[model samples]
Target: MATLSAGGQQDAACMHIRELTMNACKVAHSAAGAVAEGIATGVNALLETVRPREIELDRLDREIDSAVTTHITGATEESAREMLACMKLSIGMERIGDLLLGFSNRALVAASRCEMEDVRDLTLMASRLEKMLSEVREAFEMRNLDKALAVLRSDAEIDRLRNLVFVRHLENPGGTHRSESFHVVFMTQALERAGDHVKNMAEEVCHLVSGQSVRHLLRSIDKPLEQMFLDQLRTKHAL
Candidate 1:
């Protein structure tokens, strides 16, 4: 057995970190591909394409955690924040993989029964989320603040689609298998959660690039919501 000398050991460790980081990146790309293929193949073939990747995703996430712990050796504040962001990004990707798996399972159950009340919104949700995942990966890779902001902005439509599905479910959640509607609901919930994780990753990317939170950007875009709260406060004060 050839023993590694001290410098060789350091080089080996650095190479491990690089491989781990690339695997973390591969997890993100694989999840994104799974999501896109799931959407394209519809509900039935989704598991065939996506389920095969879940175990690999989990393995990549474990590698990422090990790499971050072993490689992120720095005392500066920026470095600390960068490591934190990197960890969050890994967790966010893992959560997205979980959500995609959940989506496939619930959709499979739904398929055994009936179609959704309306699938148009669900289709749109999947498409938008696929785009968001790609943008998140790219923004993080490039550290482009604007691209990160766009990824965050795209999450709003996912939220809207989730709300639409819920409203539709409330209106006509009646079928031979009334429980079937809830499967669609569950699927939408998974997609919504996946979008949330994408947003989380995007926020971390924004933080990495700007060294600041994205809350201010949100507040600026949500002026109408702020005004609505202000109006409610004024009405309460008058009462």
Candidate 2:
């Protein structure tokens, strides 16, 4: 093998970091998919899909920590930025994995008790979370800012699903409460928190590839859909 130059070595290190980060992301995305599948199918499917993967996510997290520690020592400025982004991405993915596992645990107990509407809302939340993770991965791989923005926009739907679930469970006008309402609310919150982490990843991707925050990028955008999202976000935050 030829001796590699310092820059070549850094490039190789950055690639390793990116790959590790992507692996963690995939596991997180898988966890979200498991939640949807579990809620849709049954507990057996959830156990098969979710139980063993937490260990895998933990292993990936450790490997990413090692990669960042080993690679950042002599990295050039650009490479260091890339490594930091990888580090941030891995952190978010790990948290998402944990949240999804918790969601699965709640789902395992909640499945038999859940009504059709409960199942419907929770499954939709999981599906949206999975989509957000998918788009974030695509954005990272392609350095596509639009995909990242799409992930950001998709989060609004997840939040809306969450609010709908809460209103049905907590504020039911009929004054009827289901026994599984607690579990349903917890599961919704778990998926919503996971979406928040995914949103963070999307924002990180925006900053990583463009050197600007998502808000700054939105400010310069002229697209109607994106502008609508920004306005709604502003209105929501104002409330």
Q: Per-model C-alpha lDDT, please?
A: 0.69, 0.86
Model 2 bad stretches (over 4 Å): 222-226, 230-239
lDDT of 2: 0.86
Task: Give lDDT tens digits, candidate 2, residues 36-90.
Answer: 8878877657646776677788888888888889989999988898889988888
lDDT of 1 by residue, 1-239 (tens): 98987556555655564455446656656655555555545546655566666667677678767766765664245555665576777777777778888877766555445444445666678788878877777786677887887776678778988997787676654533345676778888988988988888888888788767777655656654345445555787999
Q: Which stretches of candidate 1 lie over 4 Å from their true place?
A: 1-26, 29-43, 74-80, 112-117, 171-179, 216-239
Least accurate stretch of 10 residues (summed lDDT) in model 2?
A: 219-228
Error of 2 at 37 (Å): 1.1
Q: Return the top candidate by lDDT.
A: 2
lDDT of 1: 0.69
What C-alpha RMSD separates each model from the true structure?
A: 7.8, 4.3
